[model samples]
Target: MLEMAKIVVQKTGEQIPVMYNPTELSLNKTVVLLGQGSNIQFQRVEDDDLTVSLFFDTYEQQIDVRTKTDKIAALTQPTVGTADRREPPVVVFTWAGPLFTGMISKLDQKFTMFLRSGIPVRAELSVTFKRVLTPEEDQHDQGKFNCRQLWLVRENDRLYMIAQKTLGSPDQWRLIAQTNGIYNVLDFPTREDVGRTLVIIDTHGETFNEVGNV
Candidate 1:
């Protein structure tokens, strides 16, 4: 059987499964032009954007389709007391494998069907996601060649759990914390840590394991 496409919240391990898989996807990127005509060159690439249409149907269940699309819309809202930053939660869109890891940049919802009481029974959602890269990666053009395997932090990740996954031992969490300079060793993977890149390097600067980027 074929699997359904879904958006996973990197903060709370919540899985928002779409009613149907996407039939098509659109990807785009921007390039910067530098220098004069002869010396003109592609300066840098920015904003890897992914767009997909999701469909939600609650007709058989006799429920409002907004109940599903609202979850996707919430991802574009800022967290409490963070109005100044306007940073929404990051999410990963996955189907059979990882597709993209980014925050929801644009969301457009259209209700196509309704019940007798005017309750929406079907909705079409157009979601656009902007790819996020680590600061180290963003400065690659500045002679920064330091690249290593990194684990993309996901929802509900604990220090011990990460150590076990990467280093093959739960007791190595302290070593990981020390290597990463994390003071809060006990409560790791804070909300701020989610959707971030994590490197599993030992004190000797040897990598253990990490997931590949999409």
Candidate 2:
């Protein structure tokens, strides 16, 4: 009555189904400290990561180790030329519905149970993915230009880290500082500024109506 989970490689446009669905899936959310005190701050959703463990067997399923290895390797391989700075191919993990869309962040494989000829008959693969939010999706919530979000400073909380967690990329930290009128880099939020608030301006550089304190 349920469909098995499958990983689709967009570059090759090939879908590889696992022999057995993973028993568990792990998801993580990012949280920042509001100050040196006991208070904790909740930020916007960061990139969503997914991990899937798969088992490959040749003795029982007629699928050889090489076949499985090649399939997994293809998922991790770079799709574009070296001269191009674009990232590797995007991977989609789907089951009954689309689960995640992103690139493979890590892949671990192990081979065990070899035949007398030294051929591996059984193998295992552990894959992890980092979610990439598209522009449309990034601005989807109340529209980026009109959405207002605030984050409280924490001990050792840097603009870059905050940007990475909130904007999905650390490179956007300058925009955060600029939007908040933080001209002096030395005045950047530190433990002393823990109770201070910083405005999260989206990529469009538009100012939204400010919400209450965090």
Candidate 3:
């Protein structure tokens, strides 16, 4: 399993602090968040000034993958049907419990992000796992596990449904965190931060629109 590390959010303006309970959030819990759509950016005002904060949380865990025979093989290679699709392995997890409902009101409209700042805006959550180093433990194991990162967008209809089908799992949130570089996932947003620009990619893996000055 993965463990949650610290969370950090980068944005424009001054520094903003994040608050959490160290007891429940100790080193072993998997940090997660829930959403409705691809609009991952949000903002809020504090001290009469506009501050934007990117929302990302972190978790630490080891992904479990099983092996077959005694002869070791490169399991990370792509298969025939899945050939030429050398994308990163992604997992997404959902916070489907009482804590999710409680956090709704806390994040609503109390957030905002500037779209004009042209800065590298990022919100990240992370997970840190203990490293096991032993030959015997490696040879005879139930499965394989490793550190994985993912990029996190909002849980919209398209991504939410697509992830379930593509990844074959709905709550494997580590994939989302890996894609979005979220090591620390619960780093909340502020009022002065600006969101990153959107890049519209086409079917042939080409850019359809100009970036920044579009």
Candidate 4:
């Protein structure tokens, strides 16, 4: 099998850059625009000549829906058993596949990943690399890389799941956040803020003492 590791995405302008300067670039931070749409560029390094396959998680069908009058439909309602309205599966990434033809390179490979409604587009994940060779007993045939896990990117979060997945632990969140220059996680749940919290409470006895003094 092919030995694979976590894939890291460093953000860039939407237009793919023909070349990158490793010195000025941020290694783990990704930039998202504030407007309606954000452009993202991905940079990853992989062993040469390995085939990569893409898998999309299928969404579970919705079994319960409310009517316009606020009435809940019965479980036996015909719509419940009917074939679900198949939403077009958004294509997240399209590239050369080991589904047959092989061979990939170090240069920037371009592709697009699309998001569809009802799907959680943002997520945290653990990537486990595996090698699958086509020939049953061919020792020389190296394997391919598959997505080992897909997870959610919670709200009020900064780092993507890719960091944790790659590192095999959630503690890696700070490394990702610090690399991005986000000092306060309260504002954004980047690494610096993942487990940081503050709380306050008043003592009833202290309140009585103050009132009596007044």
Candidate 5:
């Protein structure tokens, strides 16, 4: 059986349980790609974003729509009255040992059913979360690099720009293309390459050489 997923708010240390676990969860990730006439270039991928739809109701339940909405709002809101002035609460959704950590980027609620007095009795919340990586996590990921690094295409990213950024020179762009098996030397990269992961070879501090020469 799948374990229930719970959202944990770091600021208030509150754990909000979903009344009915989301039947479907959507995760979105994309790479940056640019379009040129008749050609495509691969770029870098963006961070993962998560979206989940939650249902809340008072049908034979003690918590009403108003109360449940209020609790969720608190988890999504920024903390107040602190001298440090921190960002909005960091939320973690954990289920079956896998976890996603992020801040609530969007919260949309709809009241579906109402009581005779017009009070809301049932609601649905569609929440979107943008992923956040801590410095330690980023460092750990970097440490895992070996002879090759994986790069995700981002918007406005080009092979030369990525080469310069990663290997310290735009002149080494061909190395990237060669490593990724991109043989189209006649045209520039296009939007089709966006969201693609490209393998980047580490030159080991050596100068670029033709694949035939090596």
Candidate 6:
């Protein structure tokens, strides 16, 4: 069976299921451009937007279709009392898996069917979701964690021994030596060096060899 699509409110964790699956979905992105013609260049990749059309039908149950559409529409309003939330709520539009994670940026409702009293029985909704990444993801995408850290030297710790303990290979010790200015391996980390520390680079590559290279 085809699974129904749903919108999940990230703040309140409310799952608002769509009555009918959208016939089509669109994902669009715009790039940041600079200069013109011969001097033109791309500055960066800009944000993306996900657009979907949803349909609702409550004619058989004789209820207002707004009861369903209202939930999605309310996502456009800023949360009251939440001083930090000046914009609409962030939500996940999902089916099979997450299709998009964003905030509802635009919404247009069209009444297609109504009862004798003008109560909407069926409606179509056009929704636009603006893309945004969480702070952790944004930082990761920006390579903020490709940094070095400190490793304290313990008693009786040699370079190869430290390498084995910290980097999982005894032979990969030259990386540690070269990165920390430990050219005099024989004269380093003796009993007098028991309480020293070294800067451990959080990277490894084809450039790093297994031995004597330090």
Q: What is the C-alpha RMSD of each candidate to the true structure, in Å?
A: 16.6, 11.6, 28.4, 26.0, 12.0, 10.7
Counting only residues 3 or more apart in sequence or on different chains, how many pairs clash (N, Cα, C under 3 Å) in candidate 2?
0
Between candidates 1 and 4, the TM-score winner: 1
Residue 163 error for model 3, in Å? Answer: 4.5
Supply candidate 2's per-residue lDDT for 49: 81
Question: Which rank order by TM-score, best down to worst?
Answer: 6, 1, 2, 5, 4, 3
| lDDT string, candidate 4, 10-40, tens digits | 1211111111111121113233323354654
**Candidate 3 segments whose C-alpha is farther than 4 A from its true place:** 1-168, 188-214
Residues 177-210, model 3: lDDT tens digits: 3444435544422121123221211112122122
Per-candidate TM equals 0.61, 0.59, 0.15, 0.16, 0.57, 0.61
Ten-residue region with minimum lDDT total, candidate 2: 205-214
lDDT to native, each model: 0.77, 0.73, 0.25, 0.27, 0.74, 0.81
Q: Write the per-residue lDDT of candidate 6 for residues 1-214, one digit (tens) a residue.
A: 9899999998788999999998888776566678998998654454578889888999999999999999999999987335765778889999988989998989999999999999999999999998879876654544445655578888777888877766677766788888777777987787656787887665433234754352
2 versus 4: better lDDT goes to: 2
Clashing residue pairs, candidate 2? none
Compared with the true structure, what per-residue lDDT tens digits does model 1 show for residues 120-160? 99999999998877675576533234433477888788888
Summing lDDT over every window of 10 consecutive residues in candidate 4, give the lowest-scoring window.
Answer: 67-76
lDDT of candidate model 1 versus the reference = 0.77
Candidate 6 stretches greater than 4 Å from native? 30-43, 140-214
Judged by TM-score relative to the true structure, which candidate is superior, 1 or 3? 1
Higher-scoring candidate on lDDT, 1 or 2 = 1
lDDT by residue (tens digit), candidate 2, 1-214: 7688888876677888887788877767553335566665433446558888888788765446867666767767666546656566787898887888888889988998787778788888888898877777665532445666699888788887998888777767777777777766566775556788888865564322232211
Best by lDDT: 6
